[model samples]
Target chain A: MEKLTIIKVGGKIVEEADTLNQLLDNFSALPGYKLLVHGGGRSATKLAAQLGIESQMVNGRRITDAETLKVVTMVYGGLVNKNIVAGLQAKGVNAIGLTGADLNVIRSVKRPVKDVDYGFVGDVEAVNGEMLASLIHQNIVPVMAPLTHDGKGNMLNTNADTIAGETAKALAKLFDVTLVYCFEKKGVLRDADDDDSVIPVITPELFRQYVVEGVIQGGMIPKLENSFSAVEAGVSRVIITLASAINQDAGTVIKK
Target chain B: MEKLTIIKVGGKIVEEADTLNQLLDNFSALPGYKLLVHGGGRSATKLAAQLGIESQMVNGRRITDAETLKVVTMVYGGLVNKNIVAGLQAKGVNAIGLTGADLNVIRSVKRPVKDVDYGFVGDVEAVNGEMLASLIHQNIVPVMAPLTHDGKGNMLNTNADTIAGETAKALAKLFDVTLVYCFEKKGVLRDADDDDSVIPVITPELFRQYVVEGVIQGGMIPKLENSFSAVEAGVSRVIITLASAINQDAGTVIKK
Candidate 1:
């Protein structure tokens, strides 16, 4: 099979049904595409609250306390991941949802939370490209979740950006695919409020400058870092743009 | 083959490493259970806020908007689910982490959100018991996420209790094991604040009274409903208890 595009749709972009459908319609129908790695923070949090659970985070990362891990497993692996798979399937795309812990596709270590031990937070220690590629080669878009096994056989929560970055890198070695990070915002902007001010392209140096200037801090920081990592790992190109701008070539492309 | 036991562990119980290690110790020692279901709301919500994604809910149900779903897919399914699997494996339990959507084992429909559609929220409509049983029969405990696929091929947010209920019911038709709902609270309390006042037993009549008195309202409502559903479906027994009661037999038991 010809190489396909690997798109990472941030949880924010797929929050709305219409928006998700629109993005799915555009991407699933694209001439060549193979995988989608999604994040599920928003949905997980909402569901957690409904269950009267309070989430814990450390330095912008989910602490993955026991209760939080429960919600994460339920929401991300079960709810959000399947929905995306179903979305692609509804669009006539043969999508297969894969979690990092499934079949040892992705492995990691369980990190600690504060002084206490968090249940299952992973660092994406490694990726099994052979297994991942086999799935992709079977013509299934691997809709992956950022959960991994600790080699010891426990599920751990991980950064979606990190998972997507690593997966993109691994897949890039096996296929000629474009990796795009789709978010709610148009793209990397010089000014937070200006939509049209998206930096059409970013280099390693400019990307660093944006980070230092705080223009690309917080969530955008990991996104840019992941994009850069993918680009560095030989992904043909990586674009970060709003889900709405999915149809248009309007986003920041991080090039090595 | 004997029917499988679908074990659900609360997030709070495994917040720290000790708790998680203890959890793994017990989980691995189980006598060939069939499946495991987990939740991680606490961690994902905290992470969602840091990402600037406001968690949204409707009627106490998580409104899976695009951004929220991303966090969910990554954290719960990927991180936490895998952690549990890894924990089990460390003790020689051959477990496979998965979301219900992995094998289309669970299916649902896109619940309409007022005039809008909840992006990925799913009301589970079916459980692929045969598929789940196949895995269980192979001596593999399927660690599942509370996610389901809309018959239309979109992944939808499903309640973990709902997943547990349906899964228990499915297994009940085939297994001799118990369906356990482990949560942070010791047991279904007559008084929510008094954990020791565990309702050791419940009948449909008692359940109705609790509902009228609001003791079984909100989160407990679903848990109770699931328990009731499982009991009614002929599950040998359905227990609602604290995660600490994994080995002990003290908990609320719902009878048909």
Candidate 2:
């Protein structure tokens, strides 16, 4: 099987011009087949505020109301995604921007109302790996926006990490998939205050030990969990690292 | 050669839900390979006003300064494009949204300043017909946004009509292409005041005569010129018609 790298970057790295340029440079230089899944929540929030739409959040997760969904769609699928595609094109990479609805690559169900009504949010139901592999074979690098559809004309806000993990898991069947979660941090740290105290490798047992030791807490917990899940689902490797270090071997590698 | 239909729709038709749904229904019912080029200027203007960004227009063309470019990107590439893609998917059409920058499908030069500087505005230099044909062969209907790139990092505001015309012209080499311009009007009218006075069949000589006489004036001039250009470029036909009449074969058909 051919090796494919699936990189998921957060809004901060992609929002600014300089960082995004650097990130794209690294991404363009990456070997073999590649796909990018991105988040633009910060931009969405800012634009929502500018539009005077109140953003609602519950337990650190966004409550994507109708207006908020529109903002996210514009930011993630439009502004940020296009910028990346254009940048990569400038660098001679054949990057194509997409939402889950495009080609029906990802089908998601609207999250049912339970304790909280996360309006217009979607939990992914399927990732069409065959269609994606077809695109990859044609050398088209898909820049996926963190948006999914219910196959009934409704676009839903989705989590970028989940998109990356789910996409990696699905593609793992056809390729040697490596899912990389790129952000501002160097890697998972041994001490919260020390940036140099990066943990080079982590197994399932090590991940549990780190969680019990309180070194990995909050948002990082769910991210790491998603990474482990990808590894368990037959993905070859999962890396959590800085966006700038994408081409380098300088991140916490997760394995089964 | 296989027949391909390229439809260009105005922003007004896509801005509202009712009209958009109707247009999508009409579009979905069309036969053979199809592509859609759309405008979202109204949505951009609305979002710009809400964000306190003053939209500057010179002679009915937008001055795409940095701020206005962001607004347009968000509106056209993000909100409008995604909605159409998701809607088409709901109707079981394998639709993918694209800008010129995606896959380097359309490469343009930044419009040079002479009388006025239209910042970030691009004049298309080339269209990659082969790449488009590849996607079309895979049964993916592309929903194009009115955006292009300069083969550099810059994303430029382009005209929807121009995109549609250029794409049709390029695809003409591989497919028997029919370019359709759908708007509120029924067709190119003989009488400006009467909607029923549509000129049914317009040849190049008749088009020139209409322009010489005062029947074809203002915006209709350039539209007709584009239509004639498409015919010259080997496109099988160019139809200017109402959005609802797409599948009905009711419109002004331009021929050599």
Cα lDDT tens digits for candidate 1, A1-256: 3576777777776656777788788877667556778788888778777667887766667767777876777666766676677777667676666666665678787774467565668877778887678656656567887667677655678888788788878777788767777866677888888878889898899988888888778777766776777788888788888766666778888897
Model 1 misplacement above 4 A: A1-84, A91-96, A105-150, A153-256, B114-119, B151-153, B190-194, B205-222
Top-DockQ structure, candidate number: 2
lDDT of 2 at B131: 94
Writing each residue's lDDT as its tens digit, candidate 2 over A1-256 gives: 8999999999999998898899999999999999999988889889888888988889767899888999999999999999999999999889999899999999999999999999999999999999999999999999999999999998999999889999999999999999999967789999879998899999989989988989888888877888888999999999989999999999899998
Per-residue alpha-carbon lDDT of candidate 1 for residues B1-256, written as tens digits (9 for 90 to 100): 4645667875555445787788777776666565778776765676677667888776656777766776666556655666666677667676666665665677777776677566777877778787677667756678776666665754556777778788888777767758888876777888877879899888999999889988788777866776777888878778777666677878888886
Quality of model 1 by C-alpha lDDT = 0.73
Cα RMSD to the true fold for all candidates: 9.8, 1.2
Error of 1 at B231 (Å): 1.4
Every model's DockQ, to 2 decimals? 0.22, 0.91
Clash pairs, model 2 backbone: none
User: How displaced is residue A162 in candidate 1, in Å?
Assistant: 15
DockQ class, candidate 1: incorrect
